[model samples]
Target: MFHKILIANRGEIALRVLRAAKELGIQTVAVHSTADAEAMHVRLADESVCIGPPPSRDSYLNIHQIVAACEITGADAVHPGYGFLSENAKFADILDAHNITFIGPRADHIRVMGDKIEAKRTAKRLGIPVVPGSDGAVTEDAEAKRIAAEIGYPVIIKASAGGGGRGMKVARNEDDIDVALATARSEAGAAFGDDAVYIEKYLEKPRHIEVQVVGDGDGRAVHLGERDCSLQRRHQKVWEEANSPALNAADRSRIGMTVANAMADLKYAGAGTIEFLYENGEFYFIEMNTRLQVEHPVTEAITGIDLVHEQIRVASGAGLSVEQKDVQFNGHAIECRINAEDPKTFAPSPGTVSHFHTPGGLGVRVDSAVFSGYKIPPYYDSLIGKLIVHGSNRVECMMRLRRALGEFVVDGIKTTLPLFQDLVNSRDIANGDYDIHWLEKYLAKADT
Candidate 1:
C-alpha cells in the first residue's frame, strides 16, 4: 500500500478517496485551489496545500502545481477522483516520469479509452457489440452526408472527444445534416480542442447501462454487475440504480463477463466502467470511463465491495483478492445526485448554506462535504452531494429514496431536490420506463 497519497481533486470525491486511504493506514494530502481553502476535504485530510487560484486551469488542472504538492508532502501516490484530470493520460505519464504511482489504469489504457471513436473500434475488436456508425472520423461534409445516408435518418453526430452532451447534434433528415456537422465541429473544437466528430445510428429509447469492472493489471479482473443510468437530462446522469430493472440475469452475466474478459485481455489496472446503450434487447457500446464513476456507490451498496480500496490495492501491485465466483449481488440500490442548481431553470446556485440536514436510516447513505455554513463556490461543478439508498428490491429502494429526499434539506439555495421529489412520484420513473431522453421530454412537457 502507498505510505501517503495526494488527492488531485476537490469536493466530495476528494473526501471519498481520503477516507478510503486512511482506512488502509495510508496518510493523505489534499490539494485545492484558493477558492476551496475552506473545503471539507481540505479540513479532513492529514495534510493540505493550496495549489493555485480559483480557476481550475490554474489549480486542479495544473499538473505542475499538483506534482509540487505531492513532492512537498512526500506522497508516494496520487488519486484523482473523477472529473478534472482523472482520465488525462498525460497526467498519468507525468506521474510515471516522476516515479509517483497513479492509483488508476495505465497511461496507455487511458489513452485508448479517452477518445470516443477509438474506444468504439476497440470495443468492437474486443467482441463487444457497438452501434453502427462511420468507419472512422467523418471530416468532410460529403463524407458525413454519405455516412448519414448509409445509417438512415435520425442519426446523431458526436464529438470524438466530447461528453456531457456538448458538441453533439441530431439530424433527422438530410437538411439538418450540414448545420449539425458545422455546429458539432465548432463545438467539439471549443470544448475538447479536437474538432473530430463521428456519426452513429441513434436509437430513440436506449437505456444507458454500464458494467463495473476492477482489474489487477496482470491478466486478472472481476465484475460487480451493472447500473442503469437512463434517467438523464442534457446527457448528464441524475439518478442511477444497481441491478438494472431493464436487464435480465442472463444478459447481466453475459455483459459482466465480457467486460471483465476485455479488461483482462488489455491487462487493465484498477477500476473502470464499460458503458453501453441498450435498445430493445441488444446492448450497443457507447464508451468506456477509465476511472471511478460518481454512480459507483450504488454498485458498492448492492455488491458489498469497496471499489476505492480495490483500486488502491491493485495500484499497489496486489492481485484481486475476490474472484468472479466470490462476487455476490444482494438487493437493489439507488443514487440521486443532489446538485446546487435550480429544479426548474437548472441554473447554477452558489452561495452559503443557511441550514443543512441529511437523512439517515436503515439502508440510506449520504455522501457530501457541505455543512450548514459551507459556501458553494461558483468556479466548480454544481454537484454538492449524493443521496444513496438500498433495499430488498427496486420498489423498496425508490420508497426509501423518496423518503430520504423529503428529509434532505439545504436551505437558502436552489437545488434539484424538488426535481427528485417530483421524479419519485412519476409513473414512468416508478415503472423504470425511462430512457436517456425521457427526463428531457418530461421537462419539456412541464413547460406547457
Candidate 2:
C-alpha cells in the first residue's frame, strides 16, 4: 500500500478520492491552484501544495509542477481524478519513469484508447461490437463520400481525437457529406490540434450506455454493471442511471460479460468505462474512457463497490479483491449532475455560494465540495455537485431523486436544479422513454 497519494485534480472528484484514501489509512497530498487554496479537498488532505495560478494550463495541467509537488510531498502514487491529466499517456509514462505509480491503466492502453480510430480498431479486435464505417481516417472528400454511400446515407463525421460532442457532424445524405466532412475536420483541428477524421453510420435514436469495469492488470477484471446516460445536452451527460431501464436481465448480462472478458484479455488495469450506443437490440462501441467517469456514483450505488478504494488497491499491486460471481447488483440508481449554471439559458454561474444546503435521508447521496462561502472559480468546470439516489426499484429511485432535488439549495448563484426538478416530473423521463437526443429536443421544445 502507498503511504501517501497525491490527488492531481480539484472539486468534487478530488474530495471523493481523498475520502477513499483516508478510509484505507493512506495519507493524502492535495495539489491545488492559487485559486483553490481554500478548496474543501485541500482542507481535508494531510498536506497541501500550491501548483500555480488559476489558469489550468499554468496550474492543473503543468506536468513539471505536479511532478515537483509529488517529489516534495514524497507521494509514491498519483490519483488523477478525471479530466486534466487523467488520460494523458505521457503523464502516466512520466510518473512511471519517476517510480511513482499512476492509479489507472497502463500508458500504452491510455494512448491506444485515447485516439478514436485506434480505439475502434482495438475494440473490434477484442471482439466488442462496433459501428459500421471507414476502416481508418477519411482524409479526402472522395473517401468520405464513398464511405457514406457504402454505409447507406446518414453518416456521422467525427474527429479521431474528439469528445464532448466537438468535432462531430451528421450528414443525412450524399449532398451533405462534403460540408459535414469539412466542418468536422476544421473543428477537430481547432479543438484537438489533429485534423484526422472518421465516418460512422449514424443511428437515428440510440440510448447511450456504458459498462463499468475494474482490472488488476493481470488478466483479472469484473464488470460492475451498466449505466444509461441517454439524457444529454450538447453531448454532455446530464443524467445517468444504472441497469439501464431500456435493457433487461439478459441484455445486461450479455453486455456486462462481454466487456469484462475484453478487459481481462487486454489486462487493463484500474477503473475504465467502455461506452456504446444501443439501438434496436444492438450495441455499437463508441469509445473507452481510461479513467473514472463523472457518473460513476450511480454504478457504485448499485454495486456497493468503492471504486476509488479498488483503484488504489490494484495500483498498489494487490489484485482484484472481488471475483466476477461475487459482484452483485442491487436496485436502481440515478445521478443528476448539478452544475453551477443557469437553468434556462445554460450559462456558466460562477460566484460565491451564499448558502448551501444538501438533501438528506436514505438512498440519497450528494457529492460536492462547495460550502456557503466557497467561490466557484470561473477558470474550471461549472459542475458543483452530483446527487445520486438508489432504491429498491426504478420507480422508488425516481421518487427519491425528485424529493432530493427539491431539497437541494445553493444561493447567490444560478444552478441547474430547476432543470432536474422539471425533468423528474416529465412523462417521458418518468416512463424512461428517452434517447441520446431526447434532452436536446426537450430543451428546444421547452424554449418555444
**Which has the greatest lDDT?**
2
Those runs of model 1 whose alpha carbons end farther than 4 Å from true positions after fitting are none
RMSD of each: 0.9, 0.5
TM-score of candidate 1 versus the correct structure, residues matched by position: 0.99
Q: Which residue segments of model 2 deviate by more than 4 Å?
A: none
Model 2 Cα displacement at 43 (Å)?
A: 0.6
Error of 1 at 368 (Å): 0.3
TM-score of each: 0.99, 0.99
| TM value for model 2 | 0.99
Q: Assess candidate 1 and give its lDDT.
A: 0.94
On residues 1-448, what C-alpha lDDT tens digit does candidate 2 reach at each position? Answer: 9999999999999999999999999999999999999999999999999999999999999999999999999999999999999999999999999999999999999999999999999999999999999999998888888888898878999999999999999999888988999999999999999989999999999999999999999998899999999999999999999989999989999999999999999999999999999999999999999999999999899989999999999999988889999999999999999999999999999999999999999999999999999999999999999999999999999999999998998999999999999999999999999999999999999999
Candidate 1: residue pairs that collide: none
